[model samples]
Target chain A: MKQISTRLSMAVHTLCLIAMLPHECTGDFIAGSVNTNPVVIRRIMGMLKKAGLVDVRPGVGGAYLLRSPEEITLLDIYRAVNAAEEEQLFGIHVNSNIKCPVGRNIEGVLQAEFQAAQSAMEQQLSGVALKQLLSQFKE
Target chain B: MKQISTRLSMAVHTLCLIAMLPHECTGDFIAGSVNTNPVVIRRIMGMLKKAGLVDVRPGVGGAYLLRSPEEITLLDIYRAVNAAEEEQLFGIHVNSNIKCPVGRNIEGVLQAEFQAAQSAMEQQLSGVALKQLLSQFKE
Candidate 1:
């Protein structure tokens, strides 16, 4: 089974940890929790920071949410990490024969449906906040 | 931009030709319209065959739709071409630390949301029948 990038789930996990245990969330700690390298955590944290979802402390170190968990939607993290593949969730055959009506018009026709489907997924992500997601964690 | 697979679009293109120009839709001819290799068309056509959407002529050669264009939805093509990636549209980090609450629970928590999001996308695709799509083609 092929899924989208694991970066999205990692981003959400990073944020959930930050929200749950703010002071302990250094790159190393988050990495340990995420079961990945600190470099991976740093990279995702870099993306999260660039997206304004989280910010690091000055000398104290470790990262913190820039906004509340309730304010941060999964779509925010999705858009943050997936900036490169923004509107390309569904690929079309690039070089269709121009003389063929179906080939000529498939991309244009499929583009609308692809965009709509992608948006429907994104809309579902938007509806789920980090707060709601974190609430599911065991005590 | 990483799109799912051109196979979905190609599958649609393959079926459209079969529906619109049934007598002329040999694999080579369809490949010409799709602007790809006949091998690629054959592979996709094979998947469509396994999915019961189309059938190749016995001795005559070329393909025809087993079902009417109205009976086949984009979702059907999406599933057919993407059989290997069924229900994995959104990926979660695989190796989260079990000792950590966020790590242990993130996959479970995110699975529901991912499923919902994936379902929403599938639902949209299901709504778009191939008949509806071909109607948008130019005369």
Candidate 2:
């Protein structure tokens, strides 16, 4: 089946938790909320940190949002995790017969459409901020 | 990596070839153009046939487009192959901690956003007809 990676969702979830309670945000604690290993949480947090969306201190330090939730869009989280790797999005059969007209040209033919569709999806994602996502979590 | 299924592109390529030359379109011929095993072409053709987008002859026959290329949208091909299974588009982590507020609500919160993003992508796809895609292939 075709699938978008779960990294984008996981990153958003982790960020929402940190935004909700920045002081209580540790890899172990966030992992508890995400129901995954702290290692998994740290991996995603590491990506988020590299993207400047979150900050993680060394040793006993915890994680916190670098930007306000309202300022961070879902697109930010998606890009933070590099989840929009469009080449993989609509896979061209690598072994397509380069000798054949259809095979030779199919990739070029579909590239524009796939890109437009991906852009539309990302634009939709960009419209929703992390703050908006956090607001949906009922107390 | 995040990805959309390639089945949609394959189906479109197969259909474009069939539309361009309906009579000579056999699984072997399509496979030659697609550069995959005839079995793979047949598999996608099977789904397209099931979706009523194409017809495959039983004994000494080949494939043909059921509808004019002008009338078919990328969305039709997508649905034909079940490429848009939303669950696969943005996965919800099965192991999310049920006791946590963020865990309990993350799926619900992201569900709407994911749906909207998916809708936007499909809407973009719906705007482009297969005829337009076919036009992109030179010679």
Candidate 3:
């Protein structure tokens, strides 16, 4: 309900589709499969392309694979999409001033813990490769 | 910088302070410590109290420990304050109609993966008890 980023999910979904059928995907085709706008697919694909996960040709040309499915982890896609990390999944605590001792140190402590949690999340994603996701593509 | 939810940070900071001292805490006091409004502290405390993490007294009263520091985890605090799962961190993919096959299934697939990742995150947070966080509390 909260904290899980949609961009991360979009990235994984797109990558999995590509990994399932490499060298034959296009932004428009993938967009149709995802029921989203071609422009949106292209945006995500742009990120994937930048991450070296996909190789794309404009206009008549299509998108292809540049990396092995096994080498592409969910974490890879997450980072590729540049998923926003600073935002909390839900609400925030009311802001505090830096002048106070508790407020001064609060950011550092919370950030450290959040970083640890994030690391755990990344590790979990890393455990699932694009190949793994491809295996689930029963379509 | 953009999405750093002050809520989680504030909750952790507030709880850590309460856990540090062997005394009752008030929202006003906690707010003062965090340099924020007491109303915000009260809101957070309200949720914490509901979660059985803290005991709050209304009308000229303060908050006290309902659960031991060692008994609590960051995940517990997160759940208490968030009132929802962490997987929906950045919100779900919008603009895609659920009537479409891909759109309908997209939420399910993304939800599953997000839950898996969230479970892993909770596991990590559960491993780190509030006692540990309190111990790390710097003066």
Candidate 4:
């Protein structure tokens, strides 16, 4: 069974908390809620910050929301965390000689198809929002 | 950047070759095509055989395609190779107390989301045929 890493999951959760709390959230507080290390929370927050999703201040202050929950989707968080949306979701190591007919050509074709597949996946995730996830949380 | 491993990629490529070839393919033949150790090919073939994607006959005979190429998808190949689709794609390792509320709750929820995401991805790959992959082969 392939599994989703806690990093992306936790990152989304933290972002959601900030989105939910808006003005009152802190990285330490979010980390507590996520039951993870503060540094880990900060690393993810840094990415979200770069993406203009969140604002963070050093010392004595916590992270704050920059974007509305409605504007953010799971895909936003996913991309923010630097998920591999390109490349095959599974690696197939074929280091065959490029001089060989099948070896030289397969990767390009597979990558093209894989990209299309990932695009579809990103589209699905983009439609799901923090608000939608919160609804699931409420239930 | 988190990336998929080469093992699964090689396995899928190998499978695609067998699917496209005119007759039964052996590990030695596949190894030559893939430029890998025959033992490596057989090891992977063992996994594919267990997944019911291929059938193997020992003693003079090699492996043959049991499942139709069209019936299989990149995702099916992925699953057979034990590629971690949802969790850690590039291998992020973090240990949390499973007894914690966030830890316990997150795994189940995240897993479901990952599975959904993976299914969406799979459906896309499933739409493409190995025969299509054959068109891309060039020396």
Q: Mind sharing the TM-score for model 4? A: 0.81
Residue A53, model 1, lDDT:
93
lDDT of 2 at A100: 72
Per-candidate Cα lDDT values, in order, are 0.87, 0.82, 0.70, 0.69
Q: For model 3, how big is the iRMS in angstroms?
A: 4.5
* lDDT by residue (tens digit), candidate 1, A1-139: 3568888899889999999888989999999989889999888889999999999775686888999988999899988988694567887888899888888898898889899999888898899999898778857
Lowest summed lDDT over 10 consecutive residues: which window, candidate 4 chain A? A83-92
Every candidate's DockQ is 0.78, 0.67, 0.42, 0.43
On a 0 to 100 scale, what is the lDDT of residue A113 in model 2?
A: 85
lDDT of 1 by residue, B1-139 (tens): 3569888888988898998888888889999999999999989988999999999885798788888888999899998987784568887888789988788788888888999989988998899898998889857
Query: Could you give me the TM-score of model 3 versus the true structure?
Result: 0.82
Model 2 / residue B137 / CA error / Å: 3.2
Tens digits of per-residue lDDT, candidate 4, A51-133, equal 88888887756677676778888788777777555534544455675765677776777678777777877787887777666
Best by DockQ: 1
lDDT score, candidate 2, position B91: 69
> Model 4 Cα displacement at B99 (Å)?
13
For the predicted complex of model 2, DockQ is 0.67
Q: What is the lDDT of residue B127 in candidate 4?
A: 81
Error of 2 at B70 (Å): 2.0
- Residue lDDT tens for model 3, A1-139: 2344466667666776666555556776777666667888888888888888888788765766687888888778778787456434333444665665556666666667777787888788788777765655456
